[model samples]
Target: MIHCMTSFAQSERSALCDTFLEVGPDAPTLSGSWRTRDLAAHLILRERRPDAAIGMFLAPLAGRTDKIQASLAQRPFEELVDTIRSGPPKWNPMALGSIDEAANLGEFFVHHEDVLRGVDPAARRQLDPAEQKALFGVLSRMGMLTLRSCRVGVVADSPGYGRRSLRSPKDEHGNVVMTGEPSEIVLYLFGRGEVADVELDGADHDVAAFRETNLGV
Candidate 1:
Protein backbone atom coordinates (compact mmCIF):
# COMPACT_ATOMS: atom_id res chain seq x y z
CA MET A 1 0.00 0.00 0.00
CA ILE A 2 2.78 2.38 0.88
CA HIS A 3 4.60 1.66 -2.37
CA CYS A 4 1.43 2.11 -4.38
CA MET A 5 0.68 5.44 -2.70
CA THR A 6 4.16 6.71 -3.42
CA SER A 7 3.88 5.62 -7.04
CA PHE A 8 0.54 7.38 -7.30
CA ALA A 9 1.97 10.61 -5.96
CA GLN A 10 4.87 10.44 -8.39
CA SER A 11 2.50 9.82 -11.26
CA GLU A 12 0.24 12.66 -10.21
CA ARG A 13 3.19 15.01 -9.88
CA SER A 14 4.33 14.10 -13.36
CA ALA A 15 0.88 14.62 -14.79
CA LEU A 16 0.59 17.99 -13.08
CA CYS A 17 3.96 19.02 -14.42
CA ASP A 18 2.98 17.98 -17.92
CA THR A 19 -0.25 19.94 -17.67
CA PHE A 20 1.63 23.00 -16.54
CA LEU A 21 4.02 22.69 -19.48
CA GLU A 22 1.21 22.41 -21.96
CA VAL A 23 -0.60 25.42 -20.51
CA GLY A 24 2.30 27.58 -21.73
CA PRO A 25 2.66 31.21 -20.65
CA ASP A 26 -0.38 32.63 -22.38
CA ALA A 27 -3.18 30.34 -21.44
CA PRO A 28 -6.47 32.14 -20.86
CA THR A 29 -7.69 32.83 -17.38
CA LEU A 30 -10.04 30.31 -15.81
CA SER A 31 -13.54 31.29 -14.85
CA GLY A 32 -13.86 33.43 -11.75
CA SER A 33 -10.70 34.58 -9.98
CA TRP A 34 -8.50 31.57 -10.85
CA ARG A 35 -6.86 31.09 -14.20
CA THR A 36 -4.64 28.41 -15.67
CA ARG A 37 -1.55 30.49 -14.84
CA ASP A 38 -2.79 31.08 -11.31
CA LEU A 39 -3.45 27.41 -10.80
CA ALA A 40 0.03 26.55 -12.04
CA ALA A 41 1.60 29.15 -9.83
CA HIS A 42 -0.41 27.93 -6.86
CA LEU A 43 0.65 24.33 -7.45
CA ILE A 44 4.31 25.26 -7.78
CA LEU A 45 4.19 27.39 -4.68
CA ARG A 46 2.24 24.80 -2.79
CA GLU A 47 4.96 22.26 -3.51
CA ARG A 48 7.62 24.68 -2.23
CA ARG A 49 6.13 26.07 0.95
CA PRO A 50 7.76 26.97 4.30
CA ASP A 51 9.32 23.55 4.82
CA ALA A 52 11.03 23.55 1.47
CA ALA A 53 12.69 25.93 -0.98
CA ILE A 54 13.40 29.67 -0.67
CA GLY A 55 11.85 31.25 -3.71
CA MET A 56 8.90 33.66 -4.09
CA PHE A 57 6.48 31.06 -2.87
CA LEU A 58 6.63 32.62 0.56
CA ALA A 59 6.26 36.13 -0.70
CA PRO A 60 2.82 37.71 -0.01
CA LEU A 61 -0.04 35.86 -1.68
CA ALA A 62 -2.46 38.24 0.08
CA GLY A 63 -4.36 40.84 -1.91
CA ARG A 64 -3.32 38.91 -4.98
CA THR A 65 -6.60 37.48 -6.10
CA ASP A 66 -5.35 37.32 -9.64
CA LYS A 67 -2.58 34.79 -9.08
CA ILE A 68 -1.66 34.34 -12.71
CA GLN A 69 -1.70 38.05 -13.32
CA ALA A 70 0.40 38.61 -10.25
CA SER A 71 2.85 35.95 -11.32
CA LEU A 72 3.26 37.36 -14.81
CA ALA A 73 3.57 40.86 -13.47
CA GLN A 74 6.54 39.81 -11.39
CA ARG A 75 8.36 37.32 -13.67
CA PRO A 76 8.05 35.43 -16.90
CA PHE A 77 6.68 31.92 -17.07
CA GLU A 78 9.94 30.25 -18.13
CA GLU A 79 11.77 31.75 -15.20
CA LEU A 80 9.07 30.64 -12.84
CA VAL A 81 9.11 27.12 -14.24
CA ASP A 82 12.88 26.96 -14.00
CA THR A 83 12.74 28.05 -10.40
CA ILE A 84 10.14 25.41 -9.58
CA ARG A 85 12.02 22.73 -11.51
CA SER A 86 15.11 23.48 -9.44
CA GLY A 87 13.33 21.90 -6.48
CA PRO A 88 12.96 23.22 -2.96
CA PRO A 89 15.94 24.55 -1.07
CA LYS A 90 15.19 22.61 2.12
CA TRP A 91 13.05 19.52 1.96
CA ASN A 92 10.79 18.91 4.94
CA PRO A 93 11.74 15.73 6.73
CA MET A 94 8.50 15.84 8.71
CA ALA A 95 6.28 17.12 5.90
CA LEU A 96 4.89 13.72 5.18
CA GLY A 97 5.96 12.28 8.54
CA SER A 98 3.07 13.44 10.74
CA ILE A 99 0.44 12.76 8.10
CA ASP A 100 -0.06 9.22 6.93
CA GLU A 101 0.72 8.19 3.36
CA ALA A 102 -3.00 8.23 2.65
CA ALA A 103 -3.18 11.97 3.24
CA ASN A 104 -0.29 12.60 0.93
CA LEU A 105 -1.87 10.46 -1.75
CA GLY A 106 -5.06 12.45 -1.35
CA GLU A 107 -3.33 15.79 -1.70
CA PHE A 108 -1.41 14.83 -4.82
CA PHE A 109 -4.23 13.09 -6.62
CA VAL A 110 -6.91 15.67 -5.83
CA HIS A 111 -4.73 18.61 -6.71
CA HIS A 112 -3.69 16.85 -9.91
CA GLU A 113 -7.33 16.42 -10.81
CA ASP A 114 -8.04 20.06 -10.04
CA VAL A 115 -5.31 21.13 -12.41
CA LEU A 116 -6.53 18.81 -15.11
CA ARG A 117 -10.18 19.83 -14.96
CA GLY A 118 -11.35 21.17 -18.33
CA VAL A 119 -7.75 20.89 -19.49
CA ASP A 120 -7.47 17.21 -20.30
CA PRO A 121 -10.52 15.02 -20.02
CA ALA A 122 -8.74 11.86 -21.18
CA ALA A 123 -5.91 12.27 -18.69
CA ARG A 124 -8.36 13.04 -15.91
CA ARG A 125 -10.23 9.83 -16.73
CA GLN A 126 -7.11 7.84 -15.91
CA LEU A 127 -7.36 8.44 -12.16
CA ASP A 128 -7.42 5.25 -10.09
CA PRO A 129 -10.31 4.40 -7.75
CA ALA A 130 -8.09 3.39 -4.88
CA GLU A 131 -6.18 6.64 -5.06
CA GLN A 132 -9.42 8.62 -5.29
CA LYS A 133 -10.88 6.86 -2.29
CA ALA A 134 -7.79 7.75 -0.31
CA LEU A 135 -8.33 11.36 -1.31
CA PHE A 136 -12.04 11.25 -0.47
CA GLY A 137 -11.32 9.95 3.02
CA VAL A 138 -8.90 12.79 3.61
CA LEU A 139 -11.29 15.46 2.41
CA SER A 140 -14.07 14.10 4.61
CA ARG A 141 -11.77 14.37 7.60
CA MET A 142 -10.88 17.92 6.64
CA GLY A 143 -14.51 19.06 6.81
CA MET A 144 -14.56 19.97 3.15
CA LEU A 145 -18.05 18.57 2.94
CA THR A 146 -19.41 21.53 4.92
CA LEU A 147 -19.49 23.76 1.91
CA ARG A 148 -22.17 26.44 2.41
CA SER A 149 -23.14 24.52 5.54
CA CYS A 150 -24.99 22.10 3.31
CA ARG A 151 -24.91 18.32 3.79
CA VAL A 152 -24.73 15.87 0.91
CA GLY A 153 -25.22 12.10 0.57
CA VAL A 154 -23.52 9.99 -2.08
CA VAL A 155 -24.18 6.43 -3.24
CA ALA A 156 -22.17 4.35 -5.65
CA ASP A 157 -23.56 1.48 -7.74
CA SER A 158 -20.27 -0.38 -7.90
CA PRO A 159 -20.01 -3.67 -6.07
CA GLY A 160 -17.90 -3.95 -2.94
CA TYR A 161 -17.79 -0.18 -2.66
CA GLY A 162 -21.38 -0.32 -1.51
CA ARG A 163 -23.56 2.70 -0.71
CA ARG A 164 -22.04 5.79 0.88
CA SER A 165 -23.37 9.22 1.77
CA LEU A 166 -21.99 12.59 2.85
CA ARG A 167 -23.95 14.08 5.71
CA SER A 168 -23.55 16.19 8.82
CA PRO A 169 -23.81 13.40 11.41
CA LYS A 170 -26.65 15.33 12.99
CA ASP A 171 -28.78 15.51 9.89
CA GLU A 172 -31.30 12.75 9.14
CA HIS A 173 -32.16 13.36 5.51
CA GLY A 174 -29.05 13.14 3.39
CA ASN A 175 -29.10 16.31 1.28
CA VAL A 176 -27.54 14.75 -1.77
CA VAL A 177 -27.22 11.22 -2.98
CA MET A 178 -24.06 11.21 -5.01
CA THR A 179 -24.35 8.06 -7.09
CA GLY A 180 -21.75 7.26 -9.65
CA GLU A 181 -18.09 6.32 -10.07
CA PRO A 182 -15.91 6.70 -7.01
CA SER A 183 -13.70 9.22 -8.78
CA GLU A 184 -16.60 11.63 -9.24
CA ILE A 185 -17.43 11.43 -5.55
CA VAL A 186 -13.89 12.27 -4.62
CA LEU A 187 -13.81 15.24 -6.94
CA TYR A 188 -17.17 16.52 -5.74
CA LEU A 189 -16.24 16.25 -2.08
CA PHE A 190 -12.98 18.10 -2.55
CA GLY A 191 -14.64 21.02 -4.40
CA ARG A 192 -12.16 20.53 -7.23
CA GLY A 193 -15.03 20.84 -9.73
CA GLU A 194 -18.47 19.64 -10.60
CA VAL A 195 -19.38 15.98 -10.84
CA ALA A 196 -20.37 16.02 -14.46
CA ASP A 197 -19.74 12.31 -14.72
CA VAL A 198 -21.76 11.45 -11.63
CA GLU A 199 -25.51 11.17 -11.18
CA LEU A 200 -26.57 13.17 -8.15
CA ASP A 201 -30.09 12.84 -6.74
CA GLY A 202 -31.94 13.15 -3.46
CA ALA A 203 -34.43 15.32 -1.56
CA ASP A 204 -31.85 18.05 -1.58
CA HIS A 205 -32.56 21.25 -3.40
CA ASP A 206 -29.21 22.40 -2.05
CA VAL A 207 -27.40 19.80 -4.08
CA ALA A 208 -28.04 21.47 -7.40
CA ALA A 209 -27.46 24.86 -5.83
CA PHE A 210 -24.17 23.64 -4.43
CA ARG A 211 -23.22 22.26 -7.79
CA GLU A 212 -24.07 25.53 -9.45
CA THR A 213 -22.02 27.53 -7.00
CA ASN A 214 -19.07 25.14 -7.11
CA LEU A 215 -19.01 24.45 -10.83
CA GLY A 216 -17.89 27.97 -11.56
CA VAL A 217 -15.83 28.45 -8.47
Candidate 2:
Protein backbone atom coordinates (compact mmCIF):
# COMPACT_ATOMS: atom_id res chain seq x y z
CA MET A 1 0.00 0.00 0.00
CA ILE A 2 2.80 2.41 0.81
CA HIS A 3 4.48 1.71 -2.49
CA CYS A 4 1.18 2.06 -4.28
CA MET A 5 0.65 5.48 -2.74
CA THR A 6 4.16 6.69 -3.59
CA SER A 7 4.59 5.28 -7.07
CA PHE A 8 2.88 8.10 -8.93
CA ALA A 9 5.61 10.55 -7.98
CA GLN A 10 8.25 8.20 -9.30
CA SER A 11 6.32 7.67 -12.51
CA GLU A 12 5.86 11.39 -13.01
CA ARG A 13 9.55 12.00 -12.44
CA SER A 14 10.47 9.37 -15.01
CA ALA A 15 8.00 10.78 -17.53
CA LEU A 16 9.25 14.31 -16.94
CA CYS A 17 12.81 13.18 -17.52
CA ASP A 18 11.71 11.64 -20.78
CA THR A 19 10.01 14.87 -21.70
CA PHE A 20 13.15 16.88 -20.99
CA LEU A 21 15.04 14.69 -23.40
CA GLU A 22 12.34 14.71 -26.08
CA VAL A 23 11.90 18.46 -25.98
CA GLY A 24 15.63 19.10 -25.67
CA PRO A 25 16.95 21.96 -23.57
CA ASP A 26 15.66 24.87 -25.65
CA ALA A 27 11.97 24.01 -25.51
CA PRO A 28 9.70 26.49 -23.76
CA THR A 29 7.86 25.80 -20.54
CA LEU A 30 4.87 27.39 -18.82
CA SER A 31 7.02 28.65 -16.00
CA GLY A 32 7.67 32.35 -16.58
CA SER A 33 10.58 32.81 -18.98
CA TRP A 34 12.20 29.47 -18.18
CA ARG A 35 12.92 27.04 -20.95
CA THR A 36 13.42 23.30 -20.49
CA ARG A 37 17.05 23.90 -19.51
CA ASP A 38 16.16 26.37 -16.81
CA LEU A 39 13.40 24.20 -15.43
CA ALA A 40 15.65 21.17 -15.35
CA ALA A 41 18.29 23.08 -13.43
CA HIS A 42 15.69 24.33 -10.97
CA LEU A 43 14.52 20.79 -10.27
CA ILE A 44 18.04 19.49 -9.73
CA LEU A 45 18.99 22.29 -7.41
CA ARG A 46 15.77 22.08 -5.46
CA GLU A 47 16.58 18.50 -4.53
CA ARG A 48 20.35 18.57 -4.24
CA ARG A 49 21.07 22.02 -2.89
CA PRO A 50 18.95 22.63 0.14
CA ASP A 51 21.04 25.66 1.01
CA ALA A 52 19.73 27.44 -2.07
CA ALA A 53 16.32 25.78 -2.43
CA ILE A 54 14.84 27.88 0.35
CA GLY A 55 14.99 30.84 -2.03
CA MET A 56 12.17 29.32 -4.06
CA PHE A 57 9.80 30.32 -1.27
CA LEU A 58 11.74 33.08 0.40
CA ALA A 59 11.74 36.37 -1.45
CA PRO A 60 14.79 37.68 0.34
CA LEU A 61 16.89 34.76 -0.86
CA ALA A 62 15.53 34.61 -4.38
CA GLY A 63 18.46 36.44 -5.92
CA ARG A 64 20.87 33.88 -4.58
CA THR A 65 18.60 31.10 -5.74
CA ASP A 66 18.43 32.62 -9.20
CA LYS A 67 22.20 32.88 -9.33
CA ILE A 68 22.62 29.21 -8.41
CA GLN A 69 19.95 28.10 -10.81
CA ALA A 70 21.51 30.10 -13.64
CA SER A 71 24.83 28.45 -12.93
CA LEU A 72 23.24 25.04 -12.93
CA ALA A 73 21.45 25.85 -16.17
CA GLN A 74 24.81 26.17 -17.87
CA ARG A 75 25.44 22.43 -17.45
CA PRO A 76 24.59 20.05 -20.30
CA PHE A 77 20.83 19.59 -20.62
CA GLU A 78 21.11 15.83 -20.92
CA GLU A 79 23.20 15.74 -17.79
CA LEU A 80 20.65 17.80 -15.86
CA VAL A 81 17.84 15.50 -16.93
CA ASP A 82 19.95 12.51 -16.03
CA THR A 83 20.42 13.81 -12.52
CA ILE A 84 16.69 14.31 -12.11
CA ARG A 85 16.09 10.83 -13.45
CA SER A 86 18.45 9.47 -10.84
CA GLY A 87 16.28 10.90 -8.05
CA PRO A 88 17.40 12.85 -4.99
CA PRO A 89 20.80 12.17 -3.53
CA LYS A 90 20.96 10.10 -0.35
CA TRP A 91 21.87 13.15 1.71
CA ASN A 92 18.62 14.89 0.83
CA PRO A 93 15.44 14.32 2.82
CA MET A 94 13.62 13.66 -0.45
CA ALA A 95 15.74 10.52 -0.85
CA LEU A 96 13.26 8.96 1.57
CA GLY A 97 10.37 7.36 -0.33
CA SER A 98 7.62 8.98 1.71
CA ILE A 99 9.24 12.38 1.54
CA ASP A 100 9.66 12.14 -2.20
CA GLU A 101 6.04 11.10 -2.56
CA ALA A 102 4.78 13.96 -0.45
CA ALA A 103 6.97 16.64 -2.01
CA ASN A 104 7.42 15.65 -5.63
CA LEU A 105 4.13 14.01 -6.62
CA GLY A 106 2.30 17.23 -7.39
CA GLU A 107 5.50 19.07 -8.23
CA PHE A 108 6.43 16.66 -11.01
CA PHE A 109 2.85 16.23 -12.19
CA VAL A 110 2.35 19.94 -12.68
CA HIS A 111 5.81 20.45 -14.19
CA HIS A 112 5.31 17.59 -16.63
CA GLU A 113 2.13 19.27 -17.79
CA ASP A 114 3.89 22.60 -17.96
CA VAL A 115 6.34 21.25 -20.49
CA LEU A 116 3.65 19.49 -22.51
CA ARG A 117 1.34 22.48 -22.63
CA GLY A 118 4.20 24.79 -23.35
CA VAL A 119 5.20 22.72 -26.35
CA ASP A 120 1.63 22.48 -27.58
CA PRO A 121 -0.90 24.86 -26.14
CA ALA A 122 -3.68 22.37 -26.82
CA ALA A 123 -1.93 19.52 -25.04
CA ARG A 124 -3.76 17.66 -22.32
CA ARG A 125 -3.17 14.40 -20.47
CA GLN A 126 -5.76 11.97 -19.15
CA LEU A 127 -4.81 10.98 -15.64
CA ASP A 128 -5.85 7.69 -14.14
CA PRO A 129 -8.46 7.59 -11.36
CA ALA A 130 -5.89 7.00 -8.65
CA GLU A 131 -3.85 9.96 -9.86
CA GLN A 132 -6.90 12.20 -9.83
CA LYS A 133 -7.82 11.17 -6.31
CA ALA A 134 -4.31 11.76 -5.06
CA LEU A 135 -4.12 15.22 -6.68
CA PHE A 136 -7.54 16.11 -5.29
CA GLY A 137 -6.34 15.12 -1.86
CA VAL A 138 -3.46 17.56 -2.23
CA LEU A 139 -5.88 20.28 -3.27
CA SER A 140 -8.09 19.56 -0.28
CA ARG A 141 -5.14 19.92 2.05
CA MET A 142 -3.44 22.89 0.40
CA GLY A 143 -6.18 24.71 -1.53
CA MET A 144 -6.64 27.43 1.04
CA LEU A 145 -3.00 28.48 0.77
CA THR A 146 -2.85 28.09 -3.00
CA LEU A 147 -5.96 30.24 -3.52
CA ARG A 148 -5.46 32.69 -0.70
CA SER A 149 -4.72 35.60 -3.01
CA CYS A 150 -8.20 35.54 -4.47
CA ARG A 151 -10.52 38.17 -3.04
CA VAL A 152 -13.60 35.96 -3.26
CA GLY A 153 -14.38 32.52 -2.01
CA VAL A 154 -13.09 29.77 -4.26
CA VAL A 155 -14.55 26.31 -4.65
CA ALA A 156 -13.14 23.34 -6.51
CA ASP A 157 -15.83 21.06 -7.91
CA SER A 158 -14.44 17.74 -9.10
CA PRO A 159 -17.34 15.47 -9.98
CA GLY A 160 -16.13 12.20 -8.54
CA TYR A 161 -14.03 13.64 -5.76
CA GLY A 162 -16.77 16.01 -4.53
CA ARG A 163 -16.26 19.67 -3.59
CA ARG A 164 -13.63 21.42 -1.54
CA SER A 165 -14.12 24.96 -0.27
CA LEU A 166 -10.74 26.26 -1.30
CA ARG A 167 -11.43 29.63 0.18
CA SER A 168 -14.45 31.09 1.99
CA PRO A 169 -16.29 33.70 -0.01
CA LYS A 170 -14.76 36.96 1.08
CA ASP A 171 -17.89 38.90 0.14
CA GLU A 172 -21.58 38.26 -0.54
CA HIS A 173 -21.03 38.44 -4.32
CA GLY A 174 -20.76 34.64 -4.17
CA ASN A 175 -18.05 32.14 -4.77
CA VAL A 176 -16.03 31.59 -7.92
CA VAL A 177 -16.63 27.94 -8.66
CA MET A 178 -14.07 26.04 -10.70
CA THR A 179 -15.18 22.76 -12.21
CA GLY A 180 -12.66 20.31 -13.60
CA GLU A 181 -10.91 17.04 -12.98
CA PRO A 182 -8.47 16.87 -10.10
CA SER A 183 -5.45 17.04 -12.42
CA GLU A 184 -6.79 20.07 -14.24
CA ILE A 185 -7.54 21.79 -10.97
CA VAL A 186 -4.00 21.14 -9.83
CA LEU A 187 -2.61 22.69 -12.99
CA TYR A 188 -4.92 25.68 -12.73
CA LEU A 189 -4.08 26.30 -9.09
CA PHE A 190 -0.38 26.01 -9.75
CA GLY A 191 -0.26 29.10 -12.04
CA ARG A 192 -1.02 27.35 -15.29
CA GLY A 193 -4.55 28.68 -15.69
CA GLU A 194 -3.98 29.77 -19.27
CA VAL A 195 -3.53 26.16 -20.37
CA ALA A 196 -5.65 24.42 -17.78
CA ASP A 197 -8.96 23.02 -19.02
CA VAL A 198 -11.02 24.04 -15.99
CA GLU A 199 -14.26 26.03 -16.30
CA LEU A 200 -15.14 28.92 -14.07
CA ASP A 201 -18.63 30.00 -12.96
CA GLY A 202 -19.17 33.13 -10.95
CA ALA A 203 -20.50 36.64 -11.03
CA ASP A 204 -18.71 38.59 -13.74
CA HIS A 205 -17.06 40.96 -11.32
CA ASP A 206 -16.17 38.17 -8.95
CA VAL A 207 -14.63 36.20 -11.76
CA ALA A 208 -12.71 39.22 -12.89
CA ALA A 209 -11.41 39.81 -9.41
CA PHE A 210 -10.41 36.20 -9.07
CA ARG A 211 -8.62 36.24 -12.38
CA GLU A 212 -6.65 39.30 -11.45
CA THR A 213 -5.24 37.71 -8.35
CA ASN A 214 -1.98 35.75 -8.44
CA LEU A 215 -2.54 32.13 -7.43
CA GLY A 216 -0.44 29.24 -6.18
CA VAL A 217 2.57 29.05 -3.96
Write the residue-wise lDDT of candidate 1 on 2-114 in tens digits: 54544555566556556667776545432235555565565455555433223333355433433444654356666666654443345643235334254345555555565
Choose the strongest candidate by lDDT: 2
Alpha-carbon runs more than 4 Å astray in model 1:
1-4, 28-33, 47-61, 64-69, 72-74, 82-94, 97-104, 120-124, 142-148, 151-162, 169-173, 192-195, 204-217
Show how many residue pairs clash in every candidate, following the order shown. Answer: 5, 0
Worst 10 residues of 2 by lDDT: 140-149
Candidates' C-alpha lDDT: 0.51, 0.88
Clashing residue pairs in candidate 2 (N, C-alpha, C atoms within 3 angstroms): none
The C-alpha local distance difference test score for the whole of candidate 2 amounts to 0.88
Angstrom error of the Cα, residue 129, model 1: value is 4.4
Best by TM-score: 2
lDDT of 2 by residue, 112-140 (tens): 99899899998877787888888888886
lDDT of 2 at 110: 92
